[model samples]
Target: MTKALTPGSIAPPFARYSHAVEIPAGHRLVVCSGQLGIDSQGDVPPDVEGQTRLCFANIAAILAEAGMDLSDIVRINAFVTGREHLPGYMKTRDEFTGSPPPASTLMIVSGFARPEFVVEIEVIASAP
Candidate 1:
């Protein structure tokens, strides 16, 4: 199992995430590429919340392929087009993540490859 690391000496995380995670030495790691909001049908949601859901769904599928799941994720890096999307992104993220939520970083970027995409997410998962 992975251990969530949030030292008392440092400030607590701003959101539902740990500052770091300790993955056991024998675990296998899966690094997933960033996934945008588009689905198999190439449909992109216009709202940040909808798009954020799709991103996590895509990441879940990718982890499944590696014999892992969302709960196995140890770290998450997410990007949104603007600060306005922060609440939607964080809400959706909290819904998908498991207990002792993974260490995470959320950033605001100018844009994505496609203008319609409002969010993107990437994750690192580990399993024995």
Candidate 2:
């Protein structure tokens, strides 16, 4: 099992996710590249919520390719183009992971590689 950490000395995380995660011994790590909302046909979603959903879909596909799933995720890094998208991002994220949630960092960035892209997500997971 992955251990989610919330150290007593620090302020609690502002949202879902732990301060850190301690992967158990003997588990290997899976680090995924940043995923955008572009689909298999190469279309990017126009809206942040749609893009966020697609990002998770892409992540799930990568995890499946590695023989793992969301439960194995120990950490995530999310980048959004704007602040308004955060609520949707959090809702979609909570739907995917986190009984306790994985450690995460969310950032508001100026933009993405493509003008249409609204969000990007990357993750680090544990595998037995």
Candidate 3:
């Protein structure tokens, strides 16, 4: 299992994520590549909410292949095209991560490999 960490020496997390995570010994890690909003049909959603959901859906598919789920995620790196997508991102993330979410980093980038893509998410997961 993965444990969320919040050291008293440091300020608490500002949002839904922990400051760090501790994965138990003897566990292996599954690091996922950045997941884009593109669906199986090779179509990118127009809205941030749909794209955000698709990103997680792609991530979930990858995790499932590894015999794990979102609950095993320890860290997440999100790259968004604009800051306006924060609220939608947070809500969608909460839908998947539940309580004690993974350590998270949000980056506002100018663009992505494809102009139609609005968001990309990458995760690091623990596996026993």
Candidate 4:
């Protein structure tokens, strides 16, 4: 299980995530690379919501490749090109990973890996 970090007399973390994540002491960590919305055919969808969905799908696929599932994800770092599109991305994300959502970091970068990709999602999985 993962718990969201909260400062207790310490300085806050620089990153805008919910804070840090408290991973179990004995869990092995899995750091997944940033996942872009582009498909294997070398294409990125124009729609921000669609791209966000695909990006997460790619991340989940990577987890499966490592013999894990969304439940194993302790943290996530996502980058969206346009801050205005956050709601749409969040909606799609909820559809993909319902209930006890993993701890996450959402960033609004100037842009993404490709111009057409409006959103990119990355994940960190831990196994106890």
Best-matching candidate per lDDT? 1
| Candidate 2 overall lDDT versus native | 0.90
Ranking by TM-score: 1, 3, 2, 4
Span of 10 residues, lowest total lDDT, candidate 3: 92-101
Extract clashing residue pairs from model 1: none
Candidate 1 lDDT (Cα, 0 to 1): 0.93
Q: List model 4 lDDT by residue over 1-128, tens digit each.
A: 67767667787654334456677789888899888887888877888787877787788888888788777777777888776878887778767663345667778999854577778788888877
Global lDDT scores for all candidate models: 0.93, 0.90, 0.89, 0.75
TM-score of 4: 0.79
What tens-digit string does per-residue lDDT give for candidate 2 at 1-128?
Answer: 88888999999999888999988889988999999998999988788888888998999999999899888889999999889989988888888895679999999999988899989999998978
Per-prediction tally of clashes: 0, 1, 0, 0
Give the poorly placed runs of model 3, Cα more than 4 Å off: none
Best by TM-score: 1
Between candidates 3 and 4, name the one with more favorable lDDT.
3
TM-score of 3: 0.95
Estimate the TM-score of every prediction.
0.98, 0.95, 0.95, 0.79
